[model samples]
Target: MRPTVTPCEDFNAEEDAKALKKAFKGFGTDEDAVIEIITKRSNEQRREIATVYKTMYGKDLVKDLRSELRGHFEDVIVALMLEPVEFQAKELHRAVSGLGTDELSIVEILGVHDNDEVVAISNAYEGLYQTSLESDIKGDTSGTLKRLLVGLSTGRRDESCDVNEEAAVKDAQALLQAGELLFAGTEESVFNSVLCQRARCQLRLIFDAYNNLVGHPIEKAIKNEFSGTVKDALLQLIECVRDRTSYLATRLHDSMAGIGTDDRTLIRIVVSRSEKDLEDIKEVYYEKYGKSLAERIADEEEVPSDVKKVLMQLLL
Candidate 1:
């Protein structure tokens, strides 16, 4: 899947910096200019323009955006300006730091990203927050969820492409013994160990083997066995492996399905996926929801007008 936002062929960081300065210079901000310039360039180019803006005019681009823009529009622009890992880490930090823990955000982020990307996210999390992501998860969560997240935070998943059928069968048995084969006292450790360590390809084989052993899909078995957030987390991990595009499309739907939209979740998914598989996500969203993602955004009256346009631009 290709990114929606490619590197602009006629990109000029300095000129962009100047244009942005002009937009923010006097009176009311030129909202149209701000949206056009920010959304037109790739994130990397935006970073370059930020650098040139600071060097040329001694003003921070993000700070200026914050000063000029208000509400969700500012949030969208500020999110766009951040490095992807930084933005993700910031989201993770926000998810855990507040009074109420957002368990799904933590699960979704840790589950979806690959090993190297998770490692970078964890490192950035540590750098930004002065604490390990594992420590935070441990402090914020308990029992199975804690163990699962701590395992993921280590970023030690075996990423080898090869699938070992013998091992997969063994893992399948372990999973069955953990939950499906047992009526009481399900083994969370077994679930954690197998799901956290195996490569995605190996996990797929393990899933197939589990289905063979259990005479039903692994997701159904999980639903019968586990409950609550842990269950959702496990199922979501499987979903990510099965079809990440659809997983994200579902996340987008989750963010928007309810009353008074989940702006943070919506923003994070849209901004994060803008440059990676967003096209596929949009296609999946339409295929799944019976309406285009752009249409959904447009219809969300809760979304500010400027922010809606910017999101639609990313879909382009």
Candidate 2:
């Protein structure tokens, strides 16, 4: 995956900090100066700048940015400032903490992350909140969703890239029996065991085998057999495993679509993917939506110019 932010050649954390301090000084904030410095620098550089800013100025960089910036712009800056795992942990906490669960956020975060990424987020969540990520997920969700999230939070998915053709066939047959062949309903544990535990490469092969066995895509089978949050979560996992970039592209489109922008979702995707796959996401977004992400953001009157500028920089 191509990253939008590569390290600057002459990166100096103290210089960047001083530049930022100058931006925030005097009668009015130099928003452009702030944007140029924060958005162009890589996340590692930003973290270093934050450290230097604290050491030199004795002020928290985030607090200073918060005091100067407002609304979605602040959201962009703050998200950019956080370590990736920490940001993901905070987003997951926010998703599960409110009155009703943000199931999509929960699914997106948990389903898309690989075992190591999940482990990092789980550890970060615990470190940040003084509680287990799994416990929060368990309390916030119920039924199959709770089961799936709790299981996924363990980060125990088989990470081997090797595929076993025989095992794939058996898993495929097992899915058919557990879902379509059952008289009452699908077997939840069967679905969990195969979907949650298999290596992603193995899961791909199994999905192909499943299509051949069932005479339809595994997704179609999943749709026919399951419903509600469980169905959504499972399908998201399949989609994420199959093509993570497309999955994220779809997410970015969803965040910006209709009514008003889901700022949290927008910020999360932009911030998290900026240093990982935002470049590929931008490509997929254009191919899928027939308009560049930057163009789409440029057209949105609701997004403030400062926030849009920062987002566009990340897209670049």
Quick one: best lDDT, which candidate?
1
Q: Write the per-residue lDDT of candidate 2 for residues 1-316, one digit (tens) a residue.
A: 8888887888999999999999988997999998899888888999999999999999999999999988888888988898889989999999999699888887788777888899999999999999999888888888888888787788899998789999999999999999998999888888888888899889999999999997899999889988987788888888888888999899888888898888888878888888888899999989999999889889887778888888888888
Q: Write the per-residue lDDT of candidate 1 for residues 1-316, one digit (tens) a residue.
A: 7678888899999999999999987789999998888888888999999999999989899998999999989999999999999998999999888797888888789878999999999999999989989999999999998998899888899999988999999989988888866878788899889889899889989999988997888999788878998899888888988788899899888888868888888888888888888988988889999999999989998888888988988889
TM-score of each candidate?
0.97, 0.96
Superposed model 2: Cα runs more than 4 Å off: none
On the 0 to 100 scale, the lDDT of residue 170 in model 1 is 92
lDDT of all predictions: 0.89, 0.88
lDDT of 1: 0.89
The stretch of ten residues in a row with the least summed lDDT in candidate 2 is: 103-112
TM-score, candidate number 1: 0.97
